[model samples]
Target chain A: MNQQVLIQAHQRIQPFIHNTPVLTSRLLDEIAGAHVYFKCENFQKMGAFKMRGASNAILSLTQEERQKGVVTHSSGNFAQAVALAANQLGVKSYIVMPKNAPQVKKDAVRAYGGEIIESESTPIDREEMADKIRIETGATFLHPSNQDEVIYGNATAAMELLQEHPDLDYLMAPVGGGGLIAGTALAAHYFGNNCKVIGGEPSQADDAFRSLQSGKIEFNDSVNTVADGLRTNLGDRNFPIIQQHVERIILVDEDEIIQAMKLIWERLKIIIEPSCAVPFAALIKERDNFKNKNIGIILSGGNVDVKNLPF
Target chain B: MNQQVLIQAHQRIQPFIHNTPVLTSRLLDEIAGAHVYFKCENFQKMGAFKMRGASNAILSLTQEERQKGVVTHSSGNFAQAVALAANQLGVKSYIVMPKNAPQVKKDAVRAYGGEIIESESTPIDREEMADKIRIETGATFLHPSNQDEVIYGNATAAMELLQEHPDLDYLMAPVGGGGLIAGTALAAHYFGNNCKVIGGEPSQADDAFRSLQSGKIEFNDSVNTVADGLRTNLGDRNFPIIQQHVERIILVDEDEIIQAMKLIWERLKIIIEPSCAVPFAALIKERDNFKNKNIGIILSGGNVDVKNLPF
Candidate 1:
């Protein structure tokens, strides 16, 4: 919402999340021909940046609200993030996951003490299940990427990165449901000394890229990218901020995403999900434009199935 | 070498290498039943702890020796380390690699500014090529693990670990050509309040284990382990120190190594070579022996070919 709100959110989640380290590789810098600082959220508590937003959102609640518990619909990292955050904050959490979700995902949610409410594989089914639980149990429903508090919480990562390297010329993040890039945009605008924000999206699922040009939320024509995380449409809550503050959204093809992801894994020596590599791929794709600038890239997550590597 | 020597080596190489971060996972701690501190040498320059030793060994050489440059026979992380370290320190380095070494590996060496001399795929032929280079150019021949300075430099990883986590009850590493474990044993003895050193070795490449029992260097009957880095036999210089200071060596079967390596890759979200997982595998095998104690594990390297993962 504002600088003060973002700062307060960071302080609130400080006790629960990691101020994950910023790593730089000379080889990676040389490859891109730019000074690249990787804010490694892959090392975040749940192996993703969602932990920051989840912790802040849950922590921002009143005692009475927290007592009633919180609910979310996700079959991805957000499910684990909310579960772990609630478990850490001594609050009950209910996760509405698709019945056909990966068993490992189900196990992780259960391991974090969250009760899983199964739904059909459709988005409408998942949302209905979450809404039903919220009504029946008087639980608060948390959106993965659309809420103000969650966006502010996600802003803290870019805030911390700016604090460490104040001279960054551009800050970039992968465009998913738009929370991370939207939050990152707000952070860059508020805290960065003229540091602009950019977004990276899969060409197959380039709704975020499309929404910026059309000035409204847009749906993907096909959600078929290897970056499973970036297939979602932008949220109303995050779209305006993205439109007002984000400099541009770069589109990378599936081959580019896999190639960049492999390069990060090999050169940075850190595992990252395909979605996380989108921004880096964009950087590599447009290397000449950003040849000598100080760039900060947020590696959004590392929660990938290593057994099924794209490369 | 003693405390001051290790400290000096660390100081000399500090500018060239990374003081790689220490990472922990609550899940991993629960699995091992011990509070574990992972000294992430996988994040080191050239993606291995060998950088520390290679930098130190080159730095310890006299200015005249440095001008003549350094030479070594190997087709592993050490070759890259020597090249990068020498390049950074403004010294020439000649790396003798077996003719059959992977093209990617040879490219990595060349990328690091090392001159590569091809040798026959035999120990005798490799050594002869290295000797020829030394004789022709007056370059200093640096053994990958056998020499005293290299061993002392290798010890700095453990030294830094002990400095950060002085209360570690036990320090562990995978025993390869014996330099890392030997250095670790000395670091624990000198810098640790009372920390003991332990090693993990592949059961197939059980030379280190046999040498400890027979009180001499021993050759492996078969070098068929997936941990390619740990296939070498112990060196004469490091063996005596290992025998004197190392409490014991734990042998892990290949299957166990793969399982533990996957756990680390999944849980820690960090890429590591198969050899790097050996110590953690050893810890999982002997979890009961180390229950509720503070332990530190040095992740030796992260230079594995992801395309050819063991899993």
Candidate 2:
């Protein structure tokens, strides 16, 4: 990735993305045996950090490009982010989501004025449908993660985190398609190498860990985890960035993540989805690894269907 | 109330309470025909603004008073706030809650290291039970709102809000025992009387409005609102303050409060309890009255059990 592009991403997305609060918790610090500062991307626009990348990608489009409209294949936060961002820019959004996607998420996408095209469950099917839609509508396809603009946009969170806490010894975030962590790593490296960047993945979907070990992008045949947000494999563009800047990848079990989620809700009174709890789970599972460190944890999202709480 | 005591309350609870984010929605603004700034006390410590009073009351206690422990009768946010604040201060807490209180709230009180003393449903029965416990254990009974210290603590949120936006044209908050609105009125008056302070009450439990109108405290025979936090009548100490400072009391139907709760959750992605949504309900119901005004609305709490959403 060009350094200029990342810098441009920071400048372009500055006005669009919220500089979300960095919250410190004495209770969380005691539990983690470290001073932990949470960069609350869960409180970001669209209720997730995905808005940073989606808004950046959408806004980066030329006037003519926006006139033709934009398309993406996502059933989750990115779908809502793209739709909302496009709506804000007065540009049409064509979203390809799986038929089985949560109704709440689908409703949110449509409410943001997106044109939804439902497809089969698989990513291949969603991508194929997106391609068909793009061909028919002459829309620009904006990949959720495997796009340079998206990675750069995701980096904004890390930039803000590091700017707030320059002496942060360790940085951790949950990994899904590796977009957020990959971008965070790039930003951490750009800011300073002293701040070690790590990715936390659910043990049920440990493709990121496997991919990092083998130094290649790995695909999961099937994924099952209560954390609906972290079920995807690393994307093509994000894998290399992760390899370059991420210190290590840790896997946390479903039980640990649920416990973390409950802890956040009960103690911190912050409602975060299971994916956002993965970093806290990683800390609890590997306490010795982060003891007494000045840690920065990115709470990825807060878009949970309250009715279906695992607890 | 002593002038010095009010000033001291301002100093004591100012740092602990989150000036709480003032969130504005273009959609809600358009709908209300006003620029609404939501003061999110729901994000306050213990997931309620009650923490401000609880923490202040606990902190204000003499060392000898604290050594005797603290007791309070509450089945809701006050119980949890007292427990959490006392636990933080390393003081023992004795919470008297009705046996039929929500298990989630009771459990939360227990989780915060509070010793629960179950009583009958009525306030008289709970108070009798609390007095018994207070005498037997030599615990200081921290009245939820019918006390000067607690009201002062609740005032800090308003103080901060006025400081942030000095030219706020109008201020609104839900009325439950009138403590929050009373404190808010005091703060607003101390800052400036140019800003109108309106109390929002559920039509099902409009005792505050009735009490203000009749020049005497009035109690509802039965309360029936989804806003569990706003069911109580005005307190002895708080009623006078409300009569003196509150400009108008607006009553919203239960359904309006529900709709407001859903709107906050769906549009803003913030989980607010029905009680907290009352002010927004007023905004929605009385849109014409507030049109073109710079409105400040206090979202008092977010402690609703997400697993059992009313919607």
Candidate 3:
């Protein structure tokens, strides 16, 4: 995908999404010795940046496909995103979920008007369930983070950030399913004026980090980080873009992630998910590299359970 | 005192304080049965609306007064507000705190460049200590929410909300020492098109509510609410304004406050103090009155201790 594709994705989803605000804190700036701008995607619809990709993918469907509906498999924010986006667009959405998924998540999907088809608690099972629904209903299947349109859609968040603050020295986003960071890397490449792109990943789930070092796709053995959203490995659609455009990926430990998450909550006074905090944690882990630089971090989402906070 | 006062206050504090973003949530609006706009003073400097008044009060001082710095007696956000306001203006601030004040608060005040003067943990002792410091250092003693300039400063938060959403049928703020509610009432009177101002008071600290009924100031026998920022009684200066301009006071209990606070944290995805939740609780308690009408609530602060959350 090119810059034109990113621009078109933004235009398509403009009415369906919020151009989330950029927040700053002097106390946090002093703590990190850098001027930091946080693009708060936590305030986005359904409380995550996943909404952008979901909205873009759904909006790009043919009129016939739209009438038939959309299908996706997700045990997380994507389920809510696709459901809500489809509902907003007046299209039907079917979400394939693992039976063991949290009741709250299931309730959220339903609340967003998504029809859930329960699958066994496995990736292969979820995909099979989604495929069955697509075939039965003549629906369009939307990959959460592994398609050109989804990655192009996610790029708009960073594009808006750059439009507002074009002089940022570094743009950072967590390395989740690679959609967000890949989009962010492309955003910095096309829209930014020599701004470098950095990826923040949990050490326990360091697929993106290893993939960049080895120059190919990599898999994780233990998907055991508190940043549950970032456990997924990079996809073929986004991995090549990340390799070519991403400046570097930094790995942060679980404790460091929790500590950084607490600081963002306390100092920024905004609720952000643990996955969202991974990049900010990485910046803090090796702050010497960012000292006095103008930095921007895309806070991926704010869907954490306050009752069960890691802190 | 008038529209001119609020206009000047906004201009004076514009450089020092943030014109904090007004946030909205479709979920909250649907739940509350009204179109609601949240004037988020929780995102204001010092993480509370107190900064608006503190900055206005500090800026309104004479050149001579500003030179000697400012003084206040508080065990909470006001102390930090005065400290930071003073520091921002490159002036020294002396805060009279109770000896038993939280160490974290004391640290926050000091970090904001405020000098601490410890006093016995009583209203009488704190006032006496503040008076002594004022006499000794010639610093202007700023009341937390009692004086005219401070109240006018507090009014600017609502003035801003009204400017952004002028068609709001009602503007609500939590009643504490009466500064915020009094100022809000005045703002609605001057800037709104017949917009009514509502005050939310804790049943445990129902002074403002009772004062309105009595047509004079009243005091609560007990101030046993989790909303610690709202325990103080109305002062003579702000009570008259409240009686004259405020439409009514709504009493919310502790449980309602905590429930609304949780909903805001979970749905709005922002950190707000318990005191900030009182007005929303009152709105939800009496949603029928606000059904389909445009409502605005000033979120008071975001200074709650996360570890000690009621929910």
Candidate 4:
């Protein structure tokens, strides 16, 4: 939206989030032939940038809404973020997850004080179940990535990065539901010094990339990608912002994603999930276009199942 | 060693080292029943605290010695630390690693611009090879953990930790060749508010603990431990420091180490090597002794081969 709304969202959610560190690696820089600054939201509270959005959404609610509680149907980082944020604000959270969702994800949500409502492993089932819970309890239904408050809240991370390094030439992030990239674009537009925002999307799940080309929301018919987090399609609330501000969307193959993920873990010595590596993969693939430029990559999250590493 | 030496070491190596972040996890603190502060050396320049000691050793060298270069025999963190530090300081480094050392370690040393010399897979063979190289090239042979300069270099970690939180009730580190623990003890003695230093040694490789009781430098005749980094015995230079200042040594088993390592990986959302988990393992094992106290644990390194994770 506007700079004022972004600032207000940050002010409201700052107490509940971590101003995560920006990390750099010489080897990584040398490999990509650019000065790469990683805005490590992997180290954020609940280990993702989603925490900022979750906190802001809950904090924006009225006293009556807060009393009723919040509801979200997510089997990823956003689920944990909302649960933890609500718990911190002393508000109840109802998380509707798929019946076949990873046990680790379910455990993490419960650990953060979320009440689980399991549905059949389908998008329709998840949405209907969450809607039922919302109707029953009169709870606020918060979309993981498509809400206005969430997008403005996510903008704070890039805002903080801009605050530290105002002259960054390019800001890059993976396009998963188009939320993070949209927020990053807004932050760069309002705060950066001649900065452009770029999105990295997996070729297997290329809905966001297609959405940009068609100037309309698109969906993947059959998603098949290793980056489990990037399979979701774009939504109306954030798609317009992305279309207006995002410079380009780079599509990378699964192999490149795995290579990028391994490099971060080995050189940066940080655990980042497959979705987090997508931007770096794109950077590597398009090194000539960005050679020697100052780049900022949003490492989206670090919640990987160590027992099932692809590398 | 005195506080002056520790301060001097930090000043000398400050340009070449990182003031790594001190991380806190509510879940980890709850598990330990103490307010635990993790001095994350895993995020250091070489992904370990060995960088501090290695850089200090190189920086402390005479002009002629610097020209002649430095050498060490290590198959672990110190090898890469020495290689990278020497490269950073514009000094040549010769690393004599055992033939059976992991190929990934060799690649890391070479990537850091160190000349590698392969020796037979034995302690004696590795030392003889390194000593021969030292004689041939007239290079200073810097022992991985036994030398005074290295110990003072290592002390800078605890010094930095104390600089951030000087009121810590205790400081904990894994006992490998006694260098880190010994340096930690010296730092706590001089800089902390009555902070007692504690050592975490694997019960399988309990040389340091036994040496304290026997009043002599002891050896682990059959070191059978999952903590490959802590298999080395206490050395002459650091044994006296450990004996004089360390409050107590905690010995934990293999299962406990794995559990502690998993907890840190899961809750702290950081990738720590098995060796780095030793101090936390000890903390979790001895929660009663540290309950409600402010404790600092030195996360030794994060160089585990992700291909073969224990958990």
Candidate 5:
């Protein structure tokens, strides 16, 4: 929870990332009995908040390091973010994605000039493939969540959120590998000590919640959730940081997340993927926790395959 | 044609309507051989550009008239827009919608506090039903189009586009009742005389194209486009304005529109209804016309039912 690191990340990523708007939802406010402000990172570059961290991490690399290229294992938003950022910086990107990853995401990575190496769905398999690519290409491996720079970069989203609404009583975000929530909590703690930071996790993949309860990192053998972004277990690096600043981790069922996704799409007219809907799900399912308070929720991404929307 | 009316409409609607960002695509830019700036009114309030017209028309009524409430005949965006606008203004809204309209839109209207009066699909039946409601409730009839105020309000979208990108070499927008195009053309003519204003229409409902060519209003017995928003024939008021400023009307087939809709959703991660895909259809199908030029296209709406996406 180093304040200077978050500040440095903010300064590093500010030029590349969009200062996405903080949208107020009158309907959500009424429903939650709180003034709900949505920090719309869903509208960020590469269509997700991952772009902030990816861009920051990519841009921070030295010219010599960049010439060697970068590698990462992501089957979703972070893959596209890293691909696009590396493309912008004129560096090659090697994306190690699951064999079952959506064609749309693979196509996006290719469109952004990232070379993809598909691997088995398991984390070990993907990491092994990424390691092979890194060793062969002499590229730096940028972990989606475990890296310090990535977490620091992800914190800028909360920096922007708190800067826009300083009096926010609660800050909530969806937790996957815990990069976003860990970064968000660190930034909020740095900016406002009194503000409670909450993590919204899918009930089907509630590793973060269980990990928090047990005071240890936890893993799920198989994740089953419509929110594809929250399937990953909290990383070792992110778990410790999150444990320090996060007030609580609330679990929302897949059905509730789907309902929240529809509510946001119908009312806000914003196309957010199920992952981004987790926080809204938490708010809707746990309204009493946020009642009469100024709450800020981060809409993490909008990269859902329209053809495969979980209606 | 009336500068003062346009100015007044711009002033009245400026505060309510979102000046949604013009998103550009590097990939599309290379493919189209031009810089394409998408004016995303799909992100506008009520998920459509209809909000500008509906909000301005509702707010323009005299306080006494507003006290009496407002009425409109629309089964689509206008129904939701008018309902939401009236609700915002604390005015009762009576919406005459076709019984066959999608439940999602009907739900949206209801959610916005509109009282739905179901009617037959025919324009005559809709108009009669709206009129009866207006007469019974003494409510001001806010025409979806074919009204001076509504057309003026629609023009503000183009005004904002021109202000944001003054050097736009070509402007294209979908033509339904010609409300958006008429307004856009008026703004383009005033702000960028050299700019070519093209109306994009569904080939199945090419009434606007036919009307522009024949110098008279035209009608289609049964529109057969998936673009529900562009099924209507050009309104009497809008047809004349469009005929004056529009350089050409490009007719896009339903399949092209669907493909464009998919491209926007998959590429840009924006949820746009089929009608809003017309301009992109024009770009994809008639790239030769806009190659290497600075083009501005309006994304008319994003209110499509997620379950009902043509894909």
Candidate 6:
């Protein structure tokens, strides 16, 4: 929760993660009416910012704990993140997924040395199976987002961005489980030159936006957004950080997300997922609010199915 | 082309173009069975390597010629390249695009300050219109791929790659208008540590491969290839250079091009045009020929229409 913890976490995970580049486009800058700097975590190892948190969590474990391995339940980027990080650190990883998960997703996890434990097509089923694995094998149960070490680890991305462009007026990131944005808020508070942190979320899954307004954790009744990454609810650990540090959560519609994503793909020549485009969509919606200012955007990941692109 | 011209071209275009990054992938290395280095011209200004040649051609113009401006006929990356380069040099650019050319492409040219002069949907019509503009305005007619200055300019890409990794055993590039590969061969000849240059081409549009074998300029009977950029025939200015310096031309089918492209998109997390994938396709096809060797591959461009992705 403090700057020292975040700093140490960054140092610990430094050797394992890439200090990904900050890219700028003149045309993009013109369209947004701001000097936009893109922190490209899409180019990170395992192709997301999740690698930082996973590496930090796995490395923080003791030799005996590492020998017993780690277990997590997710069908998204975190699965690959933990698998790759654990493999690199010479530790075993047990990934629990629903039986209906895509073959490609399961293959990717296995490719990174994850032992898959399939369960019924439900969250409770996944969690119970992961817990059973942890109890039976004495493996550490690592939460994908709602963990202190993971949040601190995720802060390193904004830390690197602030180090490169300290004069940024605002730092924008897409809110998934609030891990990346909470860490970003911490980074901006400690290292930025009076920079404010902002979060972007889909209106269809606007739990983070309502949570900020109500000053409490909120959950969507039904998730109907194309941003598959942002469909998860904010966690207890990250929700408190979000309430205290995050400035505001902006809501964008599905069309705007697709438009912003297309612009990045066409103008910046980079592949970014729908969740990554949420922040840029917010920028476009409120261009007048931040016109001519310097902004840093976290391109969260680039792990989309290319064959099923919306635009 | 000689070393001195390439060296001087690099110096002349240094301020105008980007010294694009060279990226490496461990997984990609394992798949190709070679230590692969990719020179990312996809990240270059105008999102293609054509900018290098365009800038060189425009910068090489005399003062009077600069006052008169420059003209070219095409609807591909070259149109945008010449427009952007001329705009940067403060010279007028007249772009003759076909009437049936895609609206997105024409808009790109105009966005770069090109004066669009539409002609009938035929190569001869475009050339005639460009020739008419040249006569009317006394503007210099710059061929997209057949000119000496442009070829020398394109060579700077391989020059940079060699400078960064001089011990490369082989250099590979996709053959389009023959500008990039001809220049790459010359660069390897002059700056490399005895590096052999190889060319990749589609069998559907195998003019360069046939031209190299037949000892003369040859044309494809029907240019039925998805690699839209490599459909042009080799020209007089570049054929001799290619013949003398290039080690071999490898032909790949359409399926191979798409497969290689998907692999790059999925693994490298970068968007590249189909033409750019031809070289990697060649490398993948001849994996045994390149195993355990250090090879440098030029990723030609990243200007694909996202809506029409073949994958």
Q: Estimate each model's TM-score.
A: 0.99, 0.90, 0.98, 0.98, 0.94, 0.99
Evaluate every candidate with DockQ and list the scores. 0.83, 0.36, 0.78, 0.69, 0.55, 0.84
Candidate 4: residue A195 lDDT (0-100): 99
Over the stretch B69-101, how does candidate 5's per-residue lDDT look in tens digits?
A: 999999888998999888888999999999898
Looking at candidate 3, what TM-score does chain B attain? Answer: 0.99
Identify the runs in model 3 with alpha carbons over 4 angstroms from their true place.
none
lDDT by residue (A146-243, candidate 1, tens digit) is 99999999999999999999999999999999999989999999999999898999999999888889888889999999999898889999999999
Evaluated on the second chain alone, the candidates' TM-scores are 0.99, 0.96, 0.99, 0.99, 0.96, 0.99
Model 5 is docked with a DockQ of 0.55
Which residue runs does candidate 4 get wrong by more than 4 Å? none
Off by over 4 Å in 5: A98-102, A118-121, B90-92, B99-104, B133-138
DockQ for model 4?
A: 0.69
Compared with the true structure, what per-residue lDDT tens digits does model 3 show for residues A45-84? 9999999999999999989889999999998999999999
DockQ of 1: 0.83
Span of 10 residues, lowest total lDDT, candidate 3 chain A: A1-10
Q: Provide the lowest-lDDT 10-residue window in model 5 chain A.
A: A20-29
Global lDDT of model 3: 0.93
Model 2 chain A is weakest, by summed lDDT over 10 consecutive residues, at: A262-271
- Clashing residue pairs for model 4: none
- Whose lDDT is higher: candidate 2's or candidate 4's? 4
| Docking band of candidate 6 | high
Candidate 1 residue-wise lDDT at A64: 100
Model 3 lDDT at residue A147? 91
Error of 5 at B150 (Å): 1.0
Chain A superposition TM-score per model: 0.99, 0.97, 0.99, 0.99, 0.97, 0.99
Clash tally for model 6: 0
Off by over 4 Å in 1: none
